[model samples]
Target chain A: MSDTQTTVEPVRMGRKATQPLLIVNDLVKTFGNGVKAVDGVSFTISPGETVGLVGESGCGKSTTAKLLLRTLDPDSGEVKFGGQDLLGMRGRALRRLRSRFQIVPQNPQTSLNPRLPVRSSIEFNLRAHGVPKPERVERIAEVLEQVGLPGAYGDRFPHELSGGQLQRAAIARAISTRPELVICDEAVSALDKSIQAQILNLLAEFQKELGMAYLFISHDLSVVEHISDQVLVMYLGRIVEDGTGSQLWNRPGHPYTEALLSAAPGAERERIVLVGDPPSPANPPSGCTFHTRCPIAIEACSTKRPLLKPTAGGSHAACIRTTDLQQP
Target chain B: MTVEAQAELVIDAAGETSDAVLSVRDLTTTFTAGGQRIEALRGIDLDLYPGRVSVLLGESGSGKSVTARSILRLYGASAIIGGSAVFEGRDLVGLNEKEMQPIRGSGIALVPQDPTGSLDPVRRVGAQIVEVLRLHGVVDSKKEAQARAEELLGLVGLPDPVRAARSFPHEMSGGMKQRVAIAIAICCNPTLLIADEPTTALDVTVQAQILDLFVELTSSIGSAMLMITHDVGVAKDLADHVSVMYAGRIVEQGATSTVLDDPVHPYTKALLAAVPTPDVPRGNLIPIIGQPPVSGMTLPGCSFAPRCPVAQSSCTELVPELVSVELGHSVACPVATEFGAA
Candidate 1:
């Protein structure tokens, strides 16, 4: 199928026509031991748009997600949500804005309380936001049905439910409060192929129906390509490449992005195997963090860091040889 | 590199009929949990041909891992195992623990899924491999075992084998630990190797490299491989033969190309369609409705009937045997049998 044919037109929610819903600039987060988990990242998520964050392990994808949610404080950054300063919000302000942002974690089995029934789990969040008991009950059933789970499933414990069912319940809870933007961190990675498809379809359906945005973080490229409007490729805690899904998939300018795309199965492309492992984030290489593993690395790559610049394919790539690289 | 070369390799090692180094027939395993008998494996039959890769593909709780554990006799004492696993004219199922001692490692090696859990955290990587080599009598002296351990590490594509051997399990990455596990598995050069989801914990790039390493190592050692995984892409990339298992039974088995390209079984077809390929558009995923039958639950006929889209009344009434519709291709669904023949 063609990329354009598969693309789902974003349904505009009840927001200002032109203003972006969320805007982040120069976000930086460093750990206790001097590990730059998220370093100098910036992106914008418009209403109802799915922005995919792709990277391997230790590339700060999860850290970036946490930073965006304010679960981890950023060293320096400006986060504006709905024309309001999100990073500057505190106390009652942050709690009130909590309902507008929700996160769906990777493993639903661990995320849900084993002792609590699915109903109570969904109700807990709504009750925390001061929703009435009757409204919470009505919303619980509606959200459960929306996630393709039966109403009776609310009475069942997490251990009694299947992996797929438990994940559906978790999604139900995330959307129970009607969050405008949901952060899915490796949400469908733990599921089987069949169940993964079901979950992906559910996510897309909810996005269209509710007119919500998603910051989908996953290492799986195919899933990202299917769901994302814009894609960001991170390497060693830095955004190395950024473009629309079709633009990035069809023409990857960065060497790291090229290798990652080639490694994914079912793509009819030549495999470009890198020579060595990724360098540790704690001791990343000087010039280009990816210079140690880049297939087309030169002497300059080890000395001078390349900044993200506009490439030929209407994408931004942090590679000095972006112009010299062949189109994928 | 070519089809001709693969064909030549297949013929050079063993002729078609005598290619099976290990043949499992009517293999059944039962476990008692909370005083309830669970039929984990229900009369499974499989063949592992020498120098060829055979994949057992299934979803979780589909008995793919149980089949691997049963072949190695890794179940507890309460578990009852019934069947014959014949390897080189010997029935492994009939052999006791004392009798199966030598066959465990030297005859058949295992590459487990979780590398961190499988390796010794306290011991250096090289010492663990050396222990396996010396225990299997693959080498004579300690010095020789150490040399062989580093050599095996190098063979598995570890860039600095010496450094990797000196490092502990905690010091290495997931992919690095897996490479070390592969080195330990092939240290003895057994006739058969069982890798259970060896690359599931790794990244795509690492997984591809490990898959290549498996093919290379197995081919060089002329060892038959029985790999278990839930990913169809891994099977398509690695398997010479593919067997689709569901609810503890082999629903379909055939040559990898034939089965993947033209699947006859409904379950296999659904599985292939469910994977989110790069070419497939969003919202077009054909997800299989409902989940697999829970463990210990007895179904009258086809276990997949409740979820099968085209299941007939007869499918719920009678269990179908694995009948062949074409040469080397078998299916356990009556409706698929009729449709495939047509």
Candidate 2:
């Protein structure tokens, strides 16, 4: 009863696990012209918990993944993995930390080397981390099998495989390292519908068997709802809503969150389609960053940036006029 | 000549067929691979009215794209088309390439899946549009073509028509490139437009905008659109009528709202359930539970029977013809009567 009633997880990141696998706090990243690609984004994943980061394109969900993996440096914030603050770490420390967290990019076509055989590409990862020669071949085949690819695929190049098979190999290579957390950045976006279901099933089963956590980031609300435990909704580099998957899907708090959830393609829901593009983060809206597109926007929404406040439904929303939004 | 090859143009000499722009009848296509004949489309019948949007929905190998290619006669020597795909009153099956060339763009145009792969990466996007306009004899002079190209770029909602006219395909994003392709397809101003999964490569926000662009283009040009896609939600968003395809055949055809709100065919029902939606309460979306059969594989009974829940033994013994369920609703299944009724 409590788990269903509360949107936040009843168990908060399993305080007893062998240190948090990954932690991000007050993370901010800005591209050229001071466009904040990621702003004040924070979350945590325990040993085996999966947190879904959901948003539309340009909401900076992918940037959050890149920041945690250090593929892109954060302007200001903290990323602590395995109890070590990663922002200050450099050289071998950073490289050593990277080995503990792996990323699987969205498009396998672009990610995998089309010219190289998939087996060699997968084996390259393990060998770089000093995996023994004899063990690498067997482990490569085992991981490939784990992601539902046949063991015989070790001899085939990326071009020989279908889109589904190519994506499976991408997952196999990411897990070949046996990292503590797998950062799947829209991993299934490019796959077909039937193939998407198979891959999602593989990821779920892998998590249960290996006890690994996932920092899963995707724009697809339906996909996140099917697989995620805790769901965080972002807009313009900032988290505007965070709760359990069912809670966010049903009673979304922020207006931007409402627009995104209702706009999910597969199922019919009451939707408020916004008109304008998200204001550029370089010179974002004065108060609430979403005030430009907020349907029931108020005067205060233009002057004051509201802090993330707890609603009665146990979800958090960064909207000062959330309660009054319903009033005429 | 055989009746198949000798059939005359049935419509009046004025190139009219009542309200319909294209009327396909008993169209079947086959292919030969590795010394074996492969039946891709057994038989498909469809009608397209002027200025109406229709979706040809199906999974991979369902003959959705095959039907599109057959319409254009682009399937190469591997194909052997049967029956007739009539357009503008002529049976397209036996037409020579020289005869088909003039009819290709002036009568109908096709927009492919990935614009990046469709367009020449080395060439300028504007030049490509200009080539299509000139090839179709819509514009003769280069200056007039350039002027029309700028107008088209603006029509598709590109920010600056002048700059976009000079841009290469690589300079544009996936969404922008798709817009350029849409612009080119509409440049010829064909009576009908065939788009095959045009938004598959784009993001969700960009997808909505592109769908919006299609609606805008259709209404402004008043061209009937045959949108072939696997996304049923998109069918709901854009299609005026819908036909659900399976194993290269349409199992269900009806007005979009009636079919989506109350589908008669078992395959149609299963397809509706398979697509994941946000508003449907937390439960498993029971997909069709299997992939489409391969193109060359021969199916004895109903193509969807293996995955259908209420399949009977009789369903595997004979192929069922599409019987009318109600006005404007028809399904190719014996059990179709059980749907939308007590």
* Residue pairs with backbone overlap in model 1: none
- The reply for model 1, stretches above 4 Å from the true place, is A1-15, B1-17
lDDT of each: 0.86, 0.79
Model 1 lDDT at residue B326: 74
Provide chain B's TM-score, model 1.
0.94
Clashing pairs in 2: A266-B277, A267-B277
User: Which candidate number has the best TM-score?
Assistant: 1
Candidate 1 interface RMSD to the true structure? 1.5
TM-score of chain B of each: 0.94, 0.92
**Model 1 docking tier (incorrect/acceptable/medium/high):** medium
